[model samples]
Target: MTNKLKLYFKAAQSAKIGIWEINLETNLIYWDSVTRCIHEVSEEFIPTTKNTIDFYSIDKNRDEIELLIERAIVEGTPFNKTFQITTAKNNIKYVEGICQIEFLNKKPIRLLGTFQDITKEQNLINELQQSVEKFSSIFSSANDAIFIIDISNGIITNCNPRASELTEYDNSELVGIHNSELFPVKYRKEVRVFLKSHLTKDNYIVNETYIKTKSGLTIPVEVASGKKFKVGDQTFSVCFFRDISERRNVEENMNMLSLAASETTDTIVIANPKGKAVWANNAYLKLTGFNLQEILGEKAGYLSKGPETDKRTTDKIRKAIQDKQSIKVTILNYNKQKEKYWFELNITPIFDNNNNCINFVGVGRDVTARKEKEFELRGLLEVTSHQNNKLFNFAHIVSHNIRSHASNLSMVVDVIENTENTAEKLSYFELFKEGTEKLSETIEYLNEIITIQKNTNIEKKEIRLKDEIEKTKYALSLSIKESQISIIDTIPEDLTVCVIPAYLDSILLNLFTNAIKYRHPERKAILKIGYEIDESYTIITFKDNGLGIDLEKNGHKIFGMYKTFHGNDDARGIGLFITKNQLEAMDGKIEVESKVGMGSIFKIYLNEK
Candidate 1:
């Protein structure tokens, strides 16, 4: 190659582009050294017109490039095209060429063009275009309201269809409006402060606030705002907003329902199917002495009967809950202090949407007084029946014993009148006298029982518990010392009892004497007396470690008159019967827990003054 041609090739290589030209008349082609290099061809190779045309990519592109070249040559037109070309190594390369028709004497004869390798630039442009198209599609089709605002002027430059619908404005009306205008007047300052803080810190802001519609009504909106930049060196703020009015309304309704539930009078408790408490009203807390935090997720059976309650009643309650049915029953429940009281539970099963049992809703009311009244009436009837039976038996005994004595006396008188034997008459008179004494003793015992029955109407007054215990101890000081019995009076001095003073004394005396009389043979007698004051009742317990009765065998007859446990000559069994009557007269109660060879505890619950 000549030096000029070599310099020209070096210049084209330095430019990183190829140079090519076509001769229209002979259909010949010329390629520069850089062009040969781009096609992976030798510098000495002769490029034929057909071979060069074949270098263009096959199919429509090759045909199109040929037509463009022919048109430029024949009509003196310029042509520019970007098309793929196949090199000598069969590798595809992208090239952009600009061609100008060269004219000689007003007739197109030659074509001059410069071709450049732009594969990298074209690929980058294609990828960027795809990304822009994807983002544009997402921005227009998103369900949530979207807005692009000019940060400097606070003007909304663009908005989605959802944004227009949410603000109750058309696209034209919202495009140039200030973002603060979309918010209520009260929230404008807050919005400004938020924007300022977000811009200063370059942080994203997400919050719930009220927005004003075109009709001036406020609607709840959740907004997410952040900064964005466009290709034109324009900075904008992007906001995503969603309506939350329905969610807020639902929360308000739930709060209202909770408030109403709290104000109810009946004790209401809701438990899941697993028997864990889920919700408990205020009345329930007050009735059960449990707070919401203490009872939530706790088993409902925690409120069941304690040691003093009847097992049968508790069993019935469990069965009712298991059956998922409404139950109205009275049960004895212990309060926080372990004091027993009666309550009427009305339990109903609550079902879920599937019509399956989901929970139990129980409403309860304290019925201690009503239960006490019922027990009192039953006791009265039992007492009347016992009295009637005793009277019938007494009549029969009275007739037999009195008539036998009287007949003997009458016979003695007859014999004294008929016979003159002084010694025999005196002996007969002595026998008659003995019989009359026996009858008088029988009549006295009957009168004592009648007196006890008549004293049921004795008036009651407030009496200090400690004073009564002291006085009773003083009265039995000798017996207590002789028996070596230890009396532990744990009862508080402040505790008082509402009872008939005389009856209180009589009841305590009987209990004390019995404890001493029934002292166990194996050990020294230990007596414990204590009292507890509850909301509506005062309970006094008298416990003794003495000869405890066999409650399993003799529990029912322990309080019956003439029933005796020990074979002692003084075991008349009338003391407890009379003591129970006295306590009953004052609307009080007595309960006993005992085990053979173990011990005995007597609990007396009375009304609080």
Candidate 2:
């Protein structure tokens, strides 16, 4: 190869340009090194006239190229066009093809073409076109009226469809109009000077103004914001205008109260300095279900006070009136028909020129629904708290009480199995049966307690307190014997307490077990059970000579879950917590008094106050 030819090929390769030829008579196709690389074909792959055209995409590009080749061969025509092709690697590319015919004796024999990869340039052009189309769509379809104004002269150079609709002007008329021409005559001068201030910087602060339509109707508008745009040396401002006519009407209505008297919905009353009713608004009359004649001369709140009204609240209002000062209170009141409602009242004092109190005004509204919902929410929270405590209590009962019963049954069964005599074995079998029955009863009672927790309500029965105590004593007879604890019951036989039977049983059992579990090692443990009747409660006391808890240190946490004092190995610390929750579930509570060495006196108050 010649040096000049090598230089020419190198230049072509640098520009990604390649050369190709098609010979018509010989049915041969030739591709240079750069051309073959552009087609992504292997070096050893031979090119034939039939297979060469297949490199062009199997779409319009392939058909168009075939047509161009035939024209060049028949009429010696030349063509320059861009074609899309799929390379041997199946990657799509765009190529620019410039071809002309090579003639032999005035007839076409071969066609020569330059193929250059133009994919990157074509992709860039496509992206730029898409960006332009996107911005054009946003400008035309914007919700707010858009204006492009000459910042120097304040002339509206361009506008959107929305701008024409807002100003009631055609697109051509709106384009060349000055910005001030769109505003009312009174505001035009101000609007003109305001627009002219955008000489160096765009002012984007929203300014409120009125726009004059074609028919001279003034509509409210806000020049929402603006951005600076530049084309060559000239600068323009892109402004957005929003119609605020509805908003203006709303603001005006809020500013002015119609007649300012009957417009308000809250009850209003004017009373004399002595707090006697003098005048009342229609809302007050409607709320109380009384006419003006019936309400006049009556004390301001006399009509609403009922049998259930709180005297403390009434006294508070009376003191406020006597002092001639303003007061706000939410008081329970009744309508004329005796229906209950919660009144949120605000009282104000009016004084004369001499500063002596002359009149009083009371503004109130029925907040019964809101107050009731608040009360209901409080009750729900309490119920949730109770259910949560019961969940803990249920787990303790399952682990401790059920295990105790199971242990008794296992011991009784082993005794029955090991006994040699038939009668003794029979007696042990009966004891075993009793233990099994007790275990089953414990499970049923636990299930009942859980069901009551879910229901949030429990039914009480009149049961003899002495009988419940005796039953608990019998259940814990073995523990009492092992601990050498003496039991003394002072509750009378006929004294009955209104309580849930299962809860009473559980409460008594927990007290009995606690006395045995925490018995003093030095002194003889004695559990003295006593009760007293009061006007509001049936107080029951369970005093035990046991390892008493330190009230100063552990008083607050004695009834808390998982809290143990005195550090006994078997002190699970769950009995007292469960006992407290069970009592609370039944509208009762437990209190304790104790010293470090002395015994603990647990007083169970078992009635509602």
- Residue 121 of model 1, lDDT score: 86
Q: Which ten residues in a row have the lowest lDDT in candidate 2?
A: 250-259
Which lDDT tens digits does candidate 2 get at residues 356-418?
886788989999999999999999998888777677767777887787677667766676778
Error of 2 at 176 (Å): 82
Clashes of 1: 0
What's the true lDDT of residue 110 in model 1? 83
Clashing pairs in 1: none
Best by TM-score: 2
| TM-score between model 1 and native | 0.43
